[model samples]
Target: MNQGLIPSRYAKALFEYASEHDCDKLVFERMQALSEAFASEPSLVKAVRNPYVSRRDKIQLLTTASGSTEGDSAMTRFMELLADNNRLDMARDIALAYLKIYRREHNICLVTVTSAAPMAEAEEKRLKQLIQRHLGSATMEYNHLINPDLIGGFQVSIDNEKLDASVANELKQLRLKLLN
Candidate 1:
């Protein structure tokens, strides 16, 4: 079985179930938070995948990390289901899958831009326009970051697409050509 299949299936089922309950929005927000939590804390991933952690505790920790309100049936029930299946450890992947599904359904384009330094106002505006054009007719959410490691220029990631225009990338390509 493909490793990605499990999370995508679970995420789809959860999206449909929550939609039926008329709380898909809340579930979506919680899933976003869950994904962020996984990214920001390595320990959270460790705990979820830890053999020593109880299923109940794992669920509790996930709920808390996701900022799920007490008695939120949709979020709670989803965690419970994950626990019952011994799939709690896959929560991070599931959350990200859920976000992707939700964003697709809502026509939201997630744009991430990273540059060697902060982009000037005109550059930021140009990037936004480029993203808008790339994901035509979709709502765009843009995030910009600085990564000196790029050496210069910038990178843009939209959904599964990537545009790497950094100087480091150019140098690497040139080096490969010279080697060949």
Candidate 2:
């Protein structure tokens, strides 16, 4: 199995199932939580990836780690399927793929705004509006981050595209020009 293909296929199947059942939002949220957990708890991910772990045990650990067992039938079934298929090791990648599907289906754009200082509410609002105008017809998930090293100004990253207006970047460009 190709490394990326397995998780992508699994994610797409889960997404389609959720969409058909009108539970895509719920599953998407669950996948996001799982992805975050995989990122923060490398040990947990390692345990899941371990070939010796039984399917039942992996399911138990995953459900317990998620802190929810109160009738998310879709998620439960999905996890069981992954365990059966020996695809539990690809949980993180599946979650990532699920998120991409969710965002695409819901017309959402995840954007990060990094600046030297915290942006005021109005500034944030204006920036979001500007982004919406440029991107067109999508809801933005605006993540505001502060980086003192930026010196001043801000940078906006929408998906893979970056708009760099940071002072540090400008200075680097200036330095490069001078060197040239």
Candidate 3:
């Protein structure tokens, strides 16, 4: 299930193209829209993957799905290239890879917090502050996940690092220790 080589290659090419053309932001926006549409509409992906669908039709559908008719030429050409190669299925992964580069270039960090229930507003604010302190000058975006299986407590994830304090995780660790 892991995406390797292809997505990153395409994403790097697209990123370089955008950077060269001074349209990285525009391309990023288009890719964001494309990724969101792929997530929200299952049929869109099917259409892109369907062999019966014409290339022009696929491009048109993808453009429409992006929710913008007047998309940047670079992005439009990128979409065409993906369709021509019959690799439209990799669009989402490419977009995600592009986003990672964009975030790194923009000094933005995505943080995820998972807990048994929704966090209170005060707790959320405090958590943001704490993350901000750790991140220094970089900006932080918080995505909260509610997982009842956590039982209680929360976990915070930043890039490759994760701090797990969830009750379920703790219990599992304790069980392993006792078993040993």
Cα-based lDDT for every prediction = 0.92, 0.88, 0.85
Q: Score residue 148 of candidate 2 by CA lDDT.
A: 98
- Cα-lDDT of candidate 3: 0.85
How far residue 87's Cα lies from its native spot in candidate 3, in Å, is 2.6
* Better TM-score candidate (2, 3): 2
Tens digit per residue, CA lDDT, model 1, 62-164:
9999999887988898899999998999999999999999999999988899999988999799879878987889999788999999999999998779999
Candidate maximizing TM-score: 2
Per-residue lDDT over 1-180 for candidate 2, one digit per residue giving the tens place of the 0 to 100 score = 688998889999999999999989888888878887888888998799787988888998876665446688888888889887778888889989999989988998989999999989898899988998988988887788999999999999998899999999999999999999
Worst 10 residues of 2 by lDDT: 61-70
- Model 1: CA > 4 A from native: none
Q: Candidate 3 residues 20-115, lDDT tens each?
A: 999998777777888888888888878877889888888888776665556467867888899878778787788888988888888889899999
lDDT for residue 32 in candidate 3, whole number 0-100:
80
Each prediction's RMSD over C-alphas, in Å, is 1.7, 1.7, 2.4
Would you list the rank order by TM-score, best first? 2, 1, 3
Give the CA lDDT, 0 to 100, for residue 110 in model 1. 88
